[model samples]
Target: MTPSRVIGYVRLSRESADSTSIVRQRQIIQSTADSRGWDLVDVVEDIDVSASKRRLDRPGLSRVRAMIAGEEVEAVLVWKLDRLARSVVDFGTLLDEGINVVSCTEPLDTTSAMGRAMAEVLQVFAVLEARTIGDRLRSSIAYRVGQGDRWRGGPTPYGYRSVRHESGDGKTLEIDPSEAAYIRQAAEIVLAGGSLYSAMQAIREAGSKPRRAEAWSISSLRVVLTGDSALGRQSRHGVPIRDEAGVLVAPWEPILTVEESERLRAILAPRPLTETRRKASRLLSGLLVCETCGSRLRVNSRRTAGAQVESYGCRANGDGRVCERPASVNADQVETFLVDEFLAVVGALPVVERREVIRDVAGIAEVEEAIRHVTDSMREPGADLGALVAQLGTLTESRDALASRPAEPTIEVVESGETYAERWARSGVDERRAVLESVLTGPVPVKAIGRGYRRMDAERVAAPWAWLDEAAADFVDPYWTD
Candidate 1:
């Protein structure tokens, strides 16, 4: 007799305290699999993801669907029916796919009429529970807003902190500073017809780092300038709300003055939708160059017969140049090749060597020490101090000028290994992007080949030398091979 094919599915809502904690879900699924005498083929888990019955953002659910479509699995086991789905529509669709679902804790079996009815009822309850939780959160937020309290959640925007402030009841809520000097500078640059990129550079030149140790980017600076707290206001759905309206209010401490806020807003208010399209086009677009014309390749995406296809092509040949290259290369294929090759390259290096290299290069304390020494030298008094001060002022002016400019194009390497993966998991997307840029040297080149496929021309660019690179490559090469 063949063993029953079973795949365990687990989903946790981001709002739930234990939604994505693997230990709890794994224990429950493992116990159930042990009792049922079913062969567990795979375990799909998505963390900090929502179980929206009306939505399909759950990665675990998508995995399950793929398993069923490929006929790779016969049945799916879940801790409960709610684990499988929270929406009646999604539940019905899953049943239609003919994959049996078993809820270990609930009397949910898709095989029988009574079981199906019970599953529907359970789904209704789950949806209701999800809605109730959402409503409660919103209500709590509204209540806090009515009291003129700010919700201090997520990372505090750059140049701001969640600090205790005196409330009417003598409790404290987090607020920004009265003269958000960095924020004001950012606004001034933007209003003076400076680009957002330049404004961020200016902020950095002024020796201003984010509340976190990370350098500021245009996106981060934009978030700060447009943030409700920066404007000394509170907002919900982009609409400014008053405390009396029972909407969540930002803790009132003026950062940028009203005039500054208005000026920044004016700069951001108008844009052709094409600007966004152009930006989307340029993500990783700069990584590829036409071998013939040496022009950067452009990315184009379109839907064909319910499937979307993306390709990179030479923009220079649009006017009818005899370019031997194909019109485009498959973007998916290009990405997959790059990712696979990149991973292979990474895996080829010894973990210890990589760590040592990272440790040697990422000497944050050393950089800080250099900054301190420079600062100290500027502060000391002597006859030569006057001349030194002038030099220091010139350096400061240069640094500030550089800071106010947009960042130059650069490639960064992201350290990989168990430790690096753990840190990446905890980091925000922007933070991760910054870390990647810091360690990798780039102008990552892509070459289009046959049938809309592209390969990364790894030879064209050099990898950033970490401390490990400083050591003899011969010593590291032998260990890596062994």
Candidate 2:
């Protein structure tokens, strides 16, 4: 004489909506089970999910079906018929398996013919109600957006955070100060002529990450940097959605100015990949900039008396008369001078200045990344080599261009009185590279002294940072020449 087993089910479309709350629905089903003397198996609930979708759409509904199929329950109980299903087809399928259906709130049960008729009639109203609600919600959001209202829900975009007021009007958007700093730095780096790749590296070096991704990815950075969001304008589906007066409405202050945004956009804009660049054969390839023609110094290795001597040659000489600067500097000589200069000065700078140097290092990394990207594009299948060459000409020019010279940082603190040189001498390749890059922009230029012998002198090396500059020329990049 065991009581008949039954499983209860409930659904609440909106978490805040009070008409059909989970607690209320559970009370009704539990009471119904108590009165009918049916052994309650379990209560399945779909929170904040609409009943208008297919039965398969509701995880709770699917769970209930499996429970009944496993003979865990012989009947299903719900606060209302629509809670189980809004469609009459789904309504029939719920009872198709010979499991009786009961609606506690509705004056109906599947055991009687008249009850089935009333249940179907109630389903029509339920479906109509759900559709009406969905339509109203859509119109309301569209109206709010048209009115230039702030987006009310969803995660905050990059460089922003959600701010909730105590008055409970709902959360508003605000610039996340620390995260916003990265965005500002990005715009500055690019405005000062750094690429998106450089911006990404700078951001990571500065210790900021995007909201979603682990590290600054190319695709993610493109979406964040190129959009109107950088200007603080609200966007929908990745594009800035305009307001009634045709103005871009932003809930929070913009991270970048309009001019800055446009400049960034121009820099980020798509270009034809035509620079026929081969993979870097040397560690310092594309990092070195020529003071004469401002062209990239390509890596060249030649045999001299059965020993190989590596040198960085002017682009003009390598590519059939592109530059008047045929001068090549010994690679080892330049690298050692630059590294020595970095170790001597960088570690003694103020911690804050050290941090700035790291950011610039990231910027340098970004420029190198841009070069790699351009090189990759030119090598893609069916690339227009001629067109790509022209495009690469511009992109690679920007990539090889040196950042502004860093000021001579006054030395203050010395840990254990150890010079940066001592630390460099003891450090590994990776540590040495980081230390060097953090202080001076890469590929120390060894301009020939008086255009005489190709004597690689430390006094002739020009670094963006004062730490590496043996001679402070503060020279601007000469116009890219043939």
Candidate 3:
């Protein structure tokens, strides 16, 4: 028989730093090929890609598939069966394609029934191990979260620099003053009613750049305004949550002050009616229920002179008594109600207190350096993996110990609502709106109340500036406010 043409395939997940190093995998493949007197046809590698247990996404696997389809290779070599595939379906497909697989490190060969059984068993173990790894990672993140530590592994948000704190015992992460100043300024701009575009321009004019050369955008400004973490609050799976007593809490250093944060929230709160109309126009235009024939309502833009008005009405208006509410109500009136109701709820919040809670949480960053130091030690070369794991265990224990420590409670109160009002006064329109939306309830709901009026429900609205409904009732015009 001609010398078996052996092709090597390797794959690694992005989350792992050293799963499939090209040099290492290539060395193993070359060594195995040399020992077996096999001709190495090619080496294919997939870096930073996941091998789904049910589906393989490895580029190397794809190349192997192509080679098999083209009848170019006799056998495929892999570091292990798990590296080749985790799914039985994929394994079956590979077998059906008439390409044999050999594991250099394991006694696995697809040619024999016994070897195939072994491959199946190995695949089961691989899937189990992948799930175990995922669980462990989630547990690690949850543990860090419980300790009020930032779990998302990436650079700090813009307008803030991750600083290392070193002391006699260990190190931690803190906020860099220079970058934080920019964060504070951004918050101020939002609270002042500045537009997101203008605010971005202002940031650029002030020589402000995101941590990774990212361009400033309205969405980015909205993220900053709504990010409780910047104010030293913890965001659990993207939703901001409060402490035991419904108070904002942080897992790391705060980039903005409580006052500034509250002000920003007030500025970004949503206008329910206007938001509803906009969304309805886009998604539910002809799909809305008529409440009469139960038929879908067709959206209509009633125009007077040069201005256009929008509303939803029955699709069959001339269907006689079958249609219940055939007349159109002013969309503007409904939008106004929503805006007022949303603002009212948001303005009722104690923004200053919430900000202080965030501040206290940020103080925990003083311990982040210690955590990082330990984390780094565990990742060192030739390091005892077990010892590093033990160190992580110890760090977790220490964190719990610190959290259990008791402290005196002293309330720091702001003078009045005027505090935020003054801040808002200083903010630009766009910035103010961004701040408002960040703290407002997700979206306002509008229901038909009476002719030319609608009931707006914003019971879920939770912004520091919700109290502003009373102060700015006339400013409820969504389209003209900006």
Candidate 1 lDDT tens digits, 102-152: 787899876667877888889989889988988998786666556655542
The list of candidate 2 runs beyond 4 A from truth reads 1-3, 12-28, 45-49, 53-55, 67-72, 92-99, 149-156, 160-179, 190-221, 235-239, 242-253, 266-278, 281-334, 338-482
Q: Mind giving the per-residue lDDT tens digits that candidate 2 earns over 31-87?
A: 989998889989987888877754547898888888878888877898888778888
Give lDDT for model 2: 0.66
Q: How many steric clashes does model 3 contain?
A: 38
Ranking by lDDT: 2, 1, 3
**Whole-model lDDT per candidate:** 0.60, 0.66, 0.59
Descending-TM-score candidate ranking: 2, 3, 1
For model 3, where is the 10-residue window of minimal lDDT? 473-482
Q: Which prediction has the highest TM-score against the true structure?
A: 2
Question: What's the lDDT for residue 6 in model 3?
Answer: 77
TM-score attained by model 1:
0.48
Q: Mind giving the per-residue lDDT tens digits that candidate 3 earns over 117-217?
A: 88878877887887898899888766655655444435556544444433322223466677667666666555544566667787778877776556667
What lDDT score is found at residue 15 in candidate 2? 88
Alpha-carbon lDDT of model 1: 0.60
- Highest lDDT against the true fold, candidate: 2
